[model samples]
Each structure stands twice: as structure tokens, then as C-alpha cells.
Target chain A: MKPILECKGLGKSFGQKKAINNINLELERGKIIGLLGPNGSGKTTLLKLANNLLTPTAGEIRIAGFNPGPDTKQIVSYLPEKTYLNEWMRVKEIVEFFADFYRDFDPDKALTMLSQLGVDAKDRLKTLSKGTKEKVQLCLVMTREAKLYLLDEPIGGVDPAARDYILETIISNYHEDATVVISTHLIADIEQVLDYVIFLKDGQIALTSAVDKIREQEGKSVDSLFREVFKC
Target chain B: MGWDFETDRPIYIQIMEKIQLLILAGVYPVGAKLPSVRDLAQQAAVNPNTMQRALAQLEEEGLVITQRTSGRFVTENEEKIIQARRRLARDQVTQLLVKMRELGLGKEQILEIINEIAEEMKI
Candidate 1:
């Protein structure tokens, strides 16, 4: 399979402290990969570098064979660890913004999902419950027909009920041809859907394998292996 | 009908296999429709998404088929059930062997326990 994303000797530093170091990796299309790690393991930082929200202090990254330029941005949808949508915007307005920006935006899908989740499009972002807003963000991200999805902690702070809903939308709505790379600490909740697993530690990759291979060879769930590999 | 809370194995995959076992047992007869993904998920206390994934996997394996609006149904082919059962058995045996190894048990001990369980299960 051709890698849709590749990073070689990737490194990033915040002044004197390093967030990631000398990493090498590749992600193929049509796979759901979990980027698993503890906090400060450089999971978010590497995702940022992939999205080009930050540049690598060393090494290289290529999304769809192109550096993260406007062209690459068109193909990548990102859900940040923190809310990136303006709090002043209404829910419908946020939908409109994403619809306007991405050619593959599915407005009807977004509208249908919003109704299903019982989120009111008329409510201002400021008025909706924080958890609801996160769901809305995830829904909009799903509306995109992008090739690569960079979801940072998509279910990090949500209740288990909401987490299941969010994860379902992700699996059901992603285009069959698309690739989803979700970075989060919620392993057991997501261990079911993941086709691949990447264990990141200290900003470098510790393990990356097809989920099936990992399960077949290791004789343990990804959660168990993750605990053993990155003991807290 | 429901998910087992034991084992670190994912609940979705378990539900997926459980649905197949149900079909094999004639609980969901050939061509008989199954429960809604949401309802089954609720029954398992699993996220509906996990249930959907399990159902989707079944669809992919040809043991089940989905009709838009009508709902998912067990395939009429008994071969599909046989195949699904074989796959599930292989995985179960593999996991069992691994657990035995972890407990430092030899093949003789493992087979003895298997025989005891088989008598209990009457399978």
C-alpha cells in the first residue's frame, strides 16, 4: 500500500526541551490507526507536525506526497485537542464555515447527525454544553471528504456514552477510501475499530503494526500491550 | 445476546461473534432480521458505534446482509455460519493456548482442562 503520510527522522523541540525526536513512520490509506501514548509522549506534537500546525525541528513529513501546504490542507481534516472553533459562532454558522471551506463537505450529513445527537443548530457555540460542542466539531470533521483525518483526543474529555457516539460517527461517516488517524488515551473504548496501532513514546515510535498482526503475534489486546509497553 | 465483561478483548468483536453464534443456534434463522444495531448495543451496554462496527464486520463477512431501511438480516447460506464458527473457534483456541502458556501449563494440562470444560459444556 502506498503511504499517504510519511515522516522520516522527524523531531521537534520547544526551545531546550524536546517534544519529539528522530522519528520515522508511514501511514497508508483506508486504515484506522490509533496513535497511542501517555501525555508528553509527543502524540499531539507529532499530529501538529503532520497537520503543519507546527514544523518539525528536524526530519521531514509528507502528506499525500506533498508538504503541508494549502494543497495538503485541502485533504487533511483536523480535530485539535482544544476547541478551534470560535465560541461566538452559532452551531449552524460553524457548519457553514466548514461547508464553505471543504469541497467535500456533506451539509445534509451534518444536519442529520446534529438532529440525531439532539444538538440544536440554532444554539450559539457559547450556549451549547461543552460536550455537545465537541460532538458538533466531530460531526463537522466527519462531513469532510478528505483523504486524511487527524483527530486529536476526539473522545478525551467526553462521557463514555458520548464517547461511543463520537466514535460511531467516525467509523460510519468516514469515506471508505479515507484514512483516519486518531490520537487519544482512550484505548479500550477504541480498540475495537482500530485496524492499526502506533505506540508513540518520547516523541518517537515504539511500535507500529497492523492491529491483526499485533493481536496474532502478541496474544493480547492492544490495551494490554500498550500498558506493558508504556507503563505509567 | 450480550457482551462478556471479562478478558481484555474488545466487546465489539465479542458481540460480532456472539451474533454469529446466535445465528448458528437458529436464534436468528436464515433470512431472519436481527435487532437494530442501537438496540443490540444497548443490550450489550456498548457504544452503538461499537455495535455498528460489529454489525458492519458481519456484513463484510457475508454472514449477514444489510438492506437500506429494512435492516440487517442473517444470510440464508448455512456455509456462512459454519465459516464464521470456524474462525471464532480458531481465535478462541489461540487465546486459550496463550493463556495456558502464561500460566506455565503444558499441553497435557491444557488438554485435560479442555476435556473437563468440554464435559461441562457437553459440546
Candidate 2:
């Protein structure tokens, strides 16, 4: 089967700044992949390129065989770095909005997850804590049975306990044929769930390898390796 | 409960060791059905794919057997379990010997220390 997400000579620029440059990657199905980098390393830029939020300056990116467009959006579930929900909207209202917007969105699953996370369906987004808001957003994004999940810093800003819950949610909710790409600087917390990792350095592909291969070959965790590679 | 993993080794190997220990400790009794891969992965907070890989390795080692229609189960053969237990004990001994040798201890010294510990523990 073809890769769920593929990029060939993919480049993106914001005027004089080259946020992403010449990235080539292919992610397979049924795997959780980590897209890792430091701040300004183009992790978000690459995700935006794939999500169709920003058009690449050069090259191309494909999600499930189609370019980033309406067709690909149908199969791609994205969780942006910041919460984008309306502050006045209740948790359930956001779920309803997502259900109406995305054909694949499962409202039942979203409501169940919201309750599990202790975010009441009737609570307004403004009333929820930062971490709870993130959980609610994650619940909405994950309920979609999309082919590819682009989670940008999904665990960031959450407490340790909530982080574990989020990770467990990601693991248990994974579809055998779907692929998840989680971009974050918190490698140690997420590495165990990741099958592969792609390291981006200054918008360039520094390295990409199986997480186990790194441990077996280098006798070190991906977190340590990242520290060494991106040491200030 | 979340599974602990050492940083210097492959996670699947650690997961395999964990399951093997569970089997030997009778936590997962002989011939008992194992949890589904997704459930196991969620319990361990690891990826299902990684959990699947570990289970597959266990199956290859004869510690776990998979049925066509049913899910995975611990081996029913007591002999196989015995061999696995012995293998694990041997590995522990080999590691201890290596560490002792690195500390400039001779084989006799290591054996003497083991005897002292065994007597102290009344074993």
C-alpha cells in the first residue's frame, strides 16, 4: 500500500525566511511517528504545509495520495499548536460543529472522551482550564476516523497525569490502518509510543529512523540523541 | 499500570522481558488468554504496533501462542516455561558474573559471595 503521508523535495518559505527546505519523507500506515525539532525548526511549518494552512513555496506534499486540498482534508485530522475553538462555545457545541464540518467526525466518541477527561459537555471553552481545553480539542480531533492525524504538540501544556491520559488515548484510539504524526519537543514522554522519528534542524531533514533502531544501534534514547544533535 | 523502560535498550525487548516475567510469575497463568494488543498497549502506554511486535516475538519464543480465531495465550507446555525461566536465570547469572569480573573478582570470589548471600537469606 502507498504511504499515508509523503513529501518530495517539499520546501516552504515566508518571504526571506525559509521555514522548511527540501524535506523528503514517507510515513506508512498503522504507526505513530514523531516529528521532532526545536523551536523554529519548522516542525509547525511542515505540519501547516501538509494541512494546507500554508502553501509551500516549492515542491509538494501529499496526504493519502492527494495534494493538500479538500480531498486530503477529508482524511486528515489536525490539532494545531494553539486552541482555535470559540471561547463562548460549550464543549458539546464544539463537538457539534466538528461533526457538522467533518463527515468522518464521530460525535458519540467525542462526547465520551470529553466525559472521560472530566470536561463537562455543558462547560464553555472559556471556563475550562488550559490543559482541559487541550484535552477537549484532542478529543474532538481524535474522534474523527481520519487516515492521517497531524497532532502538533498534543501533550504540551498538560499536567503529568493528563499527559499520560492523552498518550493512552492516542494509543488506544489508533486505527490499524491510520497513521499519526505527533510533532513535539517532548521526546522522552512520547518516544515509547512512536515507531519512527523525523528530526528537523533549521528546516532540513537531519535524520529519520525507527525509534528502536536508534536505541539498539546507539544505546541511547531518542531524547538524549536529540539533545546531542540539537545542543546549543 | 504504566511500564517502565530503560533508555539504553529497544522498547520491544523491554516489553518482551516484562511479559516473560509476567508469565513466569504466574500473573498471566499458563494457557491463560492474553489481553488484546490495544488493551495491553493502553495499559503500558506504548504504541499498539510496538506491543504487537513484542507479542509476536514472544510467540516465536514459544512463550506465547496465538490461535487462528481466538487471541494470544500463554504457552500450556510446562517444559517450555521451565526452559524460559532457566534461560532468564542464566542471563541474570551471566550478567552478574560479567559485572563481578569487571570489578577484578575471580570466579571463586563471585561464587563465595553468592554462597554468603544465599546463606544470609536462608536459601
Candidate with the greatest TM-score versus the true structure: 2
Interface RMSD for each of the candidates: 5.8, 1.0
* Candidate 1 clashing pairs, residues 3+ apart or interchain: none
- Which tens-of-lDDT digit does each residue in B1-123 have in candidate 1? 235643445555677778888897889998999988756755665545557777999899899998898999999887888887788789889998998999999999989998999999999
Residue B96 alpha-carbon offset, candidate 1, angstroms: 14
True contacts kept of each: 0.11, 0.94
TM per candidate comes to 0.74, 0.95
lDDT of residue B24 for candidate 1: 78
Best candidate, lDDT-wise? 2
Off by over 4 Å in 1: B1-16, B27-123
Q: Write down the lDDT that model 1 would get.
A: 0.82
Task: For all candidates, state DockQ relative to the true structure.
Answer: 0.16, 0.85
